[model samples]
Target: MNRRHARRQGMIALALTGAMIALAGCAPEPDVQPTPTPTDSAVVPYDGPVVFVGDELESFLLTPAEVAEAIPEATGVMNASAVLEQVSDGGGTAAVPAICDALFAEQSLGSVGARVTRWMTPSDPEYGQGRVEVLQFADEQQARDRMDQLLQAAADCGQFTKEAPVTFDAEILDEVDGVRAFAGTLLDIDGGYDWRVFQAYAAVGNVVVMLNQPFTGDRTYDAQAAASLLQQRAGDARDALVADLTENPPVPEEQPVTDAAQPWSEWAIGVDGVGPVLLGDAVDVAVAAAGGTATPPTFDRGPWIVENPEATASMLIQQAEDAETVWYVTVGTRRGESAETPQDGAALPALGDVRVGMPVSEAFAALPGGTIVDVASSGEDYYAVTTREGRLFRFDTEGDAADGTAIIIGITVEDATQRASLRFG
Candidate 1:
């Protein structure tokens, strides 16, 4: 027999041995399904507020469009339910059966509900994979306990010799706040493949977010890069969940505004000699006004760049090809040991008298006549303020609201109503 056939035969022999052991009480049954529990009794009613009520997994889960943004070469997204069904039908390895048993065991996840999404490239049939699994629990404590269980399970199952001579090597990557990250490799001897996997777990309020990426290819995959990406994605997901839950929980109807608010269109920033610029202005006019040249378009977009001769200030502009208007402008102070102000006549772009480094309160006071519609935390110490006029300002605070100062860091102007509708509703 050929070497490949001989290897398959050997794997079959091992699998049979594993199956016999499993039947003899060494492993749990693969087909044991989780018992259905009443949704209300399963989880305690989130007492404070609800960003997501019921099982709207689609809203919190990363969509295929987002996956495309993260993994540019992603070909398609697979319905996680279908993938799970396939895994079930395949009658996975002996170890997999036991793992599922532990996962779905009574109270293991504490009234938890899960939804998964997977992104795949053309090569995924043989290698490469991306997936995000979100588990919503009864409370923050439950989510934390579940994460602990998952990490311990990974540690316990360090390696499996049955069914394909598989081996796992795992290491703790990082633990920030309540989030834990782990990275490892899976060696499949029978399949002739080595999979590099990175996993991150975070408990945000009453939810647990898990992001995992597994890749296999001819070229060596960088584990550090994969771990970093997983950590970033996990952190972003956790922040979004917390923001949604705490700031704008689900309500039956729109909350009435008690104070008068002005539109954001009145705000303007200087673009060099072009006088003042507002949202929806054409890209060429804005670039010329800023005394900068636009680069050739690629992927239907171009960037207008500006740099200070004295290395004190810089700006980057992005414009879309389908629209004549400039999209967004990012103005920032120069990095390193340089002094704050630009030399000679160079001046940093300004929204009225406000620029980066201005106190958060001062920036709002400088605005012509807009009301602070909402203030929400995006991540740890980072805050975003939205105005009635389609303007969003971001700031970083030292820590506490009373003792620490909030410094303006970035600003963006967009259609406020549309943005709110998409995010909150």
Candidate 2:
């Protein structure tokens, strides 16, 4: 009505609008539903009777001529019934009907079963590991299709080479009401015939039924009568895919180092007092009290024996590539010592690093074959020399000194095979 009243009404309306907007912001949104993915309906799960079923593989069937070739003795049989009877007679024992029902009764035709048995024949390497698949399949089609895939998978995994395929063919057999009953040449695959067959019947729909016999053995697996005996124990699920093949061990890579790659100078300790000893010189400074030198006289001790003398001496001077120290032979008869005044030992006067691949070995041999000596390996390349004194003197090549490291050459012997192992430290 009045201008002020109208302004107040407008303000109230603006406040109401702001409140509505805030409430809308705080309210939760509706939850969105996820889309369902489509899956194939043809994938029949592995039920008890039918282990596996492949539409394409099941369609494959052998012709009458192929069947006749598979079983030569059944050639003159008038009908399928005659062949069936023969197969039953060959199949030694009948399986319980209840075992067959568990595999096929509840499902469509793609069921599978297994049987349990021991493989004791000489031809079977797994004879020690008893085999069992005491289950059944809905019918022959399902059984054959699954077996084909399984066999192929095994071959692909290199379990069996293509040139050598494991084969088993037997006969089909059934007893009607405890009396002898028969089913014809039950199944044939890849040139192998099976006369001993265990049937797993499945009622797909109405009167349409399927019989699957997972274990079928031909004459090769056993003679006619023997084949039948194998069937009596049949009626179990197909073998589980747990144990199919083995694995291969891994091989290590090879690493080798040449003579030029050895580290020698790393053994160099310091070049102070010990350096002159290896360089064939000795030094004397002031002594706290005073010192004196000793003289020696050679004696006729015939021969002297020293064990690991050179190695022990080298160990003391090994790291002294640049140092010097006194060296002396002790407690041995000298070659020129008189018997009346025998020489107990001698101060060699000076010590030097025995260089190898040169005149070191020759010099040591000139003194005597048994004379102990320190040998140090040296060359432009890497090298190592062990003297008669059991000392391992290592010398670094130019590259080794530059790298400031040592190379280790390891030799391994395995089963008459000699291999060289190399490592850097």
Candidate 3:
């Protein structure tokens, strides 16, 4: 939540929100479309077949006409993901389910390919939202395992609590063409009626299709109809995926820039670079170094935070306050009595001088005071300061500054040096 950084929209937030509050009866959609941006003129030419997980998945997705066919009240259906720039730090959750804390628990496990199609009926007032998620597992057996997990969870997920009481129950309605349908009800925690919910799933080969749509109002959840639709779509996607695999087309395998044989990746976290990323790298380059995504420090594209789930460290990258292009990368770390702890991506201590799990004073001592550039007062207290030597970092301490045991909780090795001279004009 850096004041200077524009937070990326909460992807979990809804375009459905405006539609839900629309006046009763269908109406023309609000001007929810974004002012279009420049399209990349670089559409690389490719011969033969391409992988179905990315650009190809769109064709396999339910068409706008198809969704409109189901939720006839829908006024306009746009590519929610492509059109809307959401603020992820803002509150609101997705139709994302972890039903009974079992289904969708480990999203990454056995996942070979995945894609989502989100369509918002932004003027429907009801039945204007749904997500079609296609996930390819390692094999057919794995796909079935996911299906089994969901079914079992549904059986035991009669009730659960998420900040309040919720009652989610479902029953097998039908299974046609290998697609299983579940007609369910979602009861509001405030003792409301059981709202209808539709869940359709189908597994073909190594791929799985999940169509989840909540029955908001006049548009009821139809398990049978949805199941039939999913069965056909899943079968098609699976076939395409298999065909691609057989053709063995060489799609650019996404690899972190850090995975390359560069010494900078192992170098200390300095103004030059942090892990696989470097100071002033553009969004695309930094994203590549972060295993394909640089998580926003608070869900915004600006001030991107890169983390390695396998380790205990993280880094932040941000543009200069008012300029474009990335300015610098920061490694949030702490001082340590011992350097035994692991880092988020790279080896700790940033050249053995400053490392997380170390003492705050020691870190600051190595890189002394400078001009304060930013302040963090929410949830923590710290100062982001810059130095004449082209260094910017934040040190959040515990207890009094004099106490040796006051371990640092959050430390950032940021930079504002190079950005000071940007041509912001």
Top candidate on TM-score is: 3
Question: What's model 2's overall lDDT?
Answer: 0.24
- Arranged by lDDT, best first: 3, 1, 2
Candidate 2 lDDT by residue in tens digits, 293-362 = 2222233212112212221111111111233322211111212221233221121111132222223233
Rank list by TM-score: 3, 1, 2
* Higher-lDDT candidate of 1 and 3: 3
The positional error of residue 344 in candidate 1, measured at the CA in angstroms, is 84
Poorest stretch of ten by lDDT in candidate 3: 82-91
Expressed as tens digits, the lDDT of each residue in 353-391 for candidate 3 is 544445655654664432111112223333333332334
Displacement of residue 410 (Cα, Å) in model 2 is 54
Better of 2 and 3 by TM-score: 3
Deviation of model 2 at 108, angstroms: 17
Residue 144 displacement (Å), model 1: 2.8
What number of backbone clashes does candidate 3 have, counting pairs of residues 3 or more apart or in separate chains?
17
lDDT for model 1, please.
0.45
Q: Which runs in model 1 stand beyond 4 Å of their true positions?
A: 1-73, 76-116, 127-130, 191-203, 211-220, 233-425
- Expressed as tens digits, the lDDT of each residue in 294-314 for candidate 1 is 343444454555554445554
